[model samples]
Target: MNDEGAVTGRRGTRITSGSGRGLRGAGEAAKNAWRRGTGNRMVRRTGLVATMIVVAVGGIFAGLLVAGDTQADVGPFAARFSLTPSVSGDTDVQIPPLGSLGLDSHDGPAHLTVRLDTLDQDRTFALASDANGLAAASQTAAADLRHGVILLVERSIVAGLLGSLLLSALVFRNWRRVLASLGIAAVTLTATGAAAAITFKPSSIEEPTYNGLLANAPAVIGDARRIADQFSEYRDQLQRMVNNISKVYSTFSSLPVYEASPDTIRVLHVSDLHLNPAAWAVISAVVKQYDIDVVVDTGDINDWGSQLESSFADSIGSLDVPYVYVRGNHDSAVTAAAVAAEPNAVVLDNQSVTVAGLRIAGIGDPRFTPDKEADRKGGSVPEQLNASGSQLAATIAAAGTPVDIALVHDPASAGPLNGTVPLVLAGHRHAREVSFMPPVLERPETRLMVGGSTGGAGLRGLEGEEPTPLEMSVLYLDRTPALQAYDEITVGGSGTAEVTIRRHLAAGDAPGEPASPAPSAPDVESASPDPGTQASPLTSRPGVTTSSPRGN
Candidate 1:
């Protein structure tokens, strides 16, 4: 050992290690102290580190629990689409996924599922704002919000009001500190921008052929602007086309009218206007043009003759001719009522009108029907006019008015009313223009007049045949006013129309001659009007008692 009791390395001298031992013993003592010191320091460090680690883990778990607890479990999910008003105060709004909404993909049905609550909220939103413009803005915002996830915080930030307010509030605090932070952030941004310019200038996106963002700026900008302009122009054109398309959206039916041999009787034939205003316009125009004597519309005039309000009357006002509308399967009592409301219009469910020397009859527009009222039917037209063919025939038999030209809307109605009349004016098969007379036991001389007029069909078939509106036939008469033939024209487009009328000469009695005597009308079944309200006959079944308006 050394004199001072210090540990020392072997140097052929007394060791610095003390404790009455040699250098080996002293080294051992020093080693023991070093081990003890190192062990204590390590223990303290480890304890601190372990404590921190455990606390960090516990804090994380607690945070997770809080977050989980705060979150509401909105189990199943569905999306809202649109809301449509129903006749009743409310409707069960049918949607996909059976009943209540649940987890589902967005791409579902042609329609969307909407909760009534969301709809009510939107209605209120539309009414809340005072500023005219701002009000519209709010409504638009609410609509967009309702269709998406609406988060108050996200909306506030996106709207910028929250950020502006926050900045103002921060100004109330350490102004210098805020300014310094802002300055530093600005410097950092500037430096970053400069560095980016230097580093990413000619980046991996470099192209050899195109000089746009990389090579040419003005040319690219010009091209982009031109493209945007063209896009806008086309978009405007598309919008215009859409509006124009709506004009004929409901072109349901068109009636064609022409004059017969006699100076008194004219003919009205029509089909598939569906009560469209455009169609009715053409119908009324054609009826007046040829001095139509009588109007006969083919079937489909009414879905079920129950509820009719295509505003056919407004168009009917132009007609001087007596209009007789037949019931197609679509025709209903309501259709009859609407038609009958016209001063000169009549509902011939399955009946005839004998004018002059011809016995003319008409049946309903021929179409099969499983449900009467299911086809977008509304109003009270049906209850006003309801009568069967038999009843109409009986009335005709009594009136004994000879019908020179039979008017019918549906070609199917022509079968029953054929033969009784020498000429038939009927409509149906809207797109079909050249319909020939069928083999009939009625009158061999009976010729069907097919009008190829647009009462609407604004466009022609791609194949170039658009002879829909002018399917009318103009029949000229000899001295006896005998049927000579007809002059016809093919009409196309919305501007001007043309009809190619063919002359129809029946029997061997020269061009126009007496065909046959008018037959007795058949019995017509009539219903009582609105049994609940007790509506009396409109006019006590006009001459010969055709059908009582009181008929249901």
Candidate 2:
């Protein structure tokens, strides 16, 4: 009986072991099946999500293209504004027959465009005829543009939401996915709009890249530095300028078009504007009137070279020609950077650039004198300037290319550059002076021409007994890149309204020869119109050459 019981126990143990093995095998199989099913479900969900995202993004872009544009009357002009998906953000203003103005307005993946559709001739005529109409119309136009922009935004949002829903419904045939797509569209657009708004630069308007006939428009519209009291006068001046432009355009169309010599390059040299808004008007006027190929500014463009003062350099982009600039004692790196940012500007600091068929080299001043409390480094001012000038001369020598002009802010710095370049321009003395250095050794002769204050010494002019005159020079260069002649333009400051132009011939003396002494008094051709018939800034009398020295 005991043997039989032991055997029974052994059998029971074996049976239990067998059942445990079966249960373990079944559990492993079930786990494997569950993992496969879970993976499949996850993959399906991921695919659906991706499809919904793609559809939403595509629909939003389509909607924006179809419904994001709006047309409205901006004063006397009918204009259309549009928003579209883009890789980068920009604002484009398009005017028919004229060219377009482009601005880097933001850093989002969207672009905005403003197009002038048509003009209301009757409204234009009526507003132009009134003395105060331009100011009033400008205010109305700003309001209308704001309203139109708001409307466009609202419509774009609604359209994008609707478009996402439609696409989601068609693709997934599910209400949940459609709602999800709408949410995603909303989030995307909100984020994009926020980025654009945060990065938008209203000041960019002052630095637009002008193209077409509109390239010359800034001269007519003026800059944005006028005082509130001058608004009326500014408006009046704008009106008169517009009328003058129209007459000129009509005259151009009626008469034979006057074309400048193809082989001749005209350069307008201006310096020491000191942030004077009037200087921009004068520069633009001279550029347009003289058909200038390039503009060379010697320095002192700003008083302090502060970031706030940098915006004044925006006008350099509107000059419709290449603007080559160097730094002065008053200008800092901040000012140089601002000048370099303009689309048409070429900033030279111990560097060289070829512009408008002329190779030019320049160097910035070694001293920063604006901050009186700042520590002085390197050496004394004159010594540092001399070193900088020597460095530039070395750089030009290494280039193995002939530089047509060399620019410096201080005459002291210019001494080391003698015989290095044919023409060296400087502008620190605040007086127009010219001298020719005879060739030494194998070096060629060099002409040093100094320009006066283009802004009439800026606000400092008020402190002087006599107002400083606004001065600039126009240089004519032949295809050989040699100086042919130059005109000295002097405008009376402190409300003098008098303009004088003195022309000088560079062909009077042979190369390497000493320049003759300047006449006791150079002949000046003055233009002073009556108050009732004030000549436009664009108008100037023809320049008459003086019998002064060859290098005058």
Candidate 3:
């Protein structure tokens, strides 16, 4: 019986083991089937994610290419704004007839362009004619630009998402994948936009590269820091510009135009800009109106003569005419180098050059007093200036070519050049003056013409009881390169919007004749006429004032 039981138990154990094997085999089969199902699902999801990424990238680029542009009115300008794929990360402004200005606005594979398409003449006229029109237009334009940018961004994102969804739907014919694509696109766009915002640069506006005619317009924008800090002052400048434009338009339309003889040489004399941006607009307008052949800047073009300040000299390239420059006390070696770098600039430092058919000589100031510090050389400023003038005169004599014009920053430097050069042009006093130095030792009489602050003494003009006048002169010269007549132009600065142009004829003496000794210093009468009235021609009276401050 025990033998039988053992056999039965072994059989039972064998049966149980067989049943357990069967169960294990079934479990393995189910696990394999489950693995196969899970792998297929994972493959599908991986493909969908990859597809979504591809669709998102492709759709964004397509959208940007197709619908990444918008148009809006920017003040009197109709401007088009666009985004393009680029590594330059630049914001470019294109103004037709002028040129382009480029700024490093961000680090990106994207670039922004603002192209000024057309000017609304009617709008311009309205703005120019109305005293408050420019301010109103500026505000409106700012709002319009903001709206346009928002619209552009919105359209770009919507178009991109729609494109992605359409692509996904076409590829998968499934709502889930299409919906998934939208989420992916939104995430991608959000990441890109956040990156761009993080990299955006606002100070880039201060270091713009001006191309074409707009090259000369840099000074008009002035310092970007000032623009940001003193927006009201900037608006006031715009107002002054509009008022000047209106006055110019009205004056030219009604006045009897003086047709200069074809052989006459027209020279525009400017000085003491002191980094005033408004001066560039005035200069450009005057250059165009007078058909100026050459532009002569006496000195003090910048206030600080800093390397950064040297950028103001960039406008010299855009003047479209010969620009003869002399260094003022405020201009340093760095400033001179910057002015020399311009394509059309001629820097005269104890040297002579011929420009616009006239031989010109110039000498830089003997001192640099931007900080109002006395000269470190420990000598009289005037004496040092006279020595510098003597060196210029010697250089001119050595050159053996007759110089028609002599440029100096200070009148003291101009003193020794008297009777040596026929005309000595200078600034630095911040007031206009004209003096006739009678011929001495058989030399011809020298006419000393000092220009006032062309930039209205820049920011310093604001400190006075009254805003200093913006002054410039247009000299009409004969073929002999002799001064025949000149127009002294004064534009009321800052708070005023009046422009006065007085014509003065250089008579009573031939190009080489001796003239009567004029007053040592004559009083300069500030001319403030009705907005658009042209002053009658006046006799050549000396407008020099001895009581004026020495440095600009």
Candidate 4:
């Protein structure tokens, strides 16, 4: 039978052969596409599983890293998420993880040279080819792990998004085409991911650290007192060392004069006067010997200033002049508050007071101490003391008050701004002594001085049983005292030395406001440095001699 364009071999059937071949070709093409799609879907699904594992692991690790980086009181500015390196090769040195270890400040003023050695290519290639390609995979894993943030932002983002789309498309495939679409999509994604894994590199960056610090509070008060005592000693020896006139020794400035005056004033001081009974005795004798005017006892007057029966407080009360004060690290803030509440002590913190014709302001260093009862393990990280300085400067600016003397307890806070103060008095670094950093010595707008301790030296009972308080100085300024002969006194000493105040006033001598009397040379009870003579700052006072950093 034949019909139109078709010819057939059977009697009852008429077929069109021209269109049959075309239909067959079209069916074959559609089947090919179906197979391809199924293969890609499977590949895409596998890649998605691998990516899910990668992301899950990365997230878990990232969380742990972030948690560990935060301090109880501070933050890791750069290490919001750090990569701590684990050792694999050499035992010679500790290789800090890249971008994790921050630039340290101990090297001085946040400056240093850095040297680095990264992986070599031959080794990298070997790592890429070994162990059934597992080593290559391992290397890629390590790189991705180390550069987790980078991978997360780059390849990971693409891989995740693409895999999700592919998986979605495969799931929606027609009734009989599910497996085919999943298989094809999966193959495409796997190939893309492997390529992305093989070649990823991180960019290097250098971060810089700067200096800043706040003034000492407890110390300035102590220095105020010390200067008074030393002035007395200087008065006693004035006649012997002078090449000049009649009143060779006459200590003038009194703590009261400084406290009562209203003018721009300058002060220099130190603190943590863990004065022992013996030391107090010497200090008392020194006070009476010089007839000092003004003095400030920056806390820790006794080893335990808070002990109900404290000789330090009694000694302080016995002293003749007006003295300012604040608590020490060892002293309880509550006790200090109580003391300040009374009329006996000033206990200045975040307070401003006029002194020696100058407006001197103070803020006690609130050292971040760990509460043992709470078993608080972490504390604030070491930040450049300047951060506090900036805050203080802001306070000063807001109050619109100018200061001449600054006091701090520890040397660690004497960052560059610390130098900006006319005189910064501190006591903790019994070693750094009196360093003179000029306002443009090595830098501009900066000058510093490390006042040695007043409680003499040796390990005191605080940590171990021995004695190390401080041995310090007194300052003198003439003219602000109410009377020409107003005198103040401090008494205490180590039996070996007794402080004696000897004054010979000239007719016109106005001993009223002066701390050190006019033109008198001085003598010292102990010419030899304290036992930690090796650690004494006076021995290393900037102009006195030269010493290596480690030497002191």
- Give the per-residue lDDT of model 3 (tens digit) for 400-482: 88999999999888777878888999999998877776568877889888889998887666554466778999888999878
Q: Show the colliding residue pairs in model 2.
A: none
Indicate whether candidate 1 or candidate 2 has the larger lDDT.
2
Which parts of model 1 are misplaced by more than 4 Å? 1-264, 302-309, 354-359, 366-403, 416-418, 431-444, 450-470, 474-484, 487-489, 493-552
TM for every model, in the order presented, reads 0.39, 0.51, 0.51, 0.36
Candidate 2 residues 346-368, lDDT tens each? 99999999998899999988877
- Residue ranges of candidate 2 with Cα displaced over 4 Å: 1-260, 373-375, 493-495, 509-542, 545-552
State the number of backbone clashes in model 3. 2
In each prediction, how many residue pairs overlap at the backbone (N, C-alpha, C within less than 3 A)? 82, 0, 2, 81
Which candidate wins on lDDT?
A: 2
lDDT to native, each model: 0.40, 0.75, 0.74, 0.39
Q: Give candidate 2's error at residue 330 in angstroms.
A: 0.7
Candidate order by lDDT, decreasing, is 2, 3, 1, 4
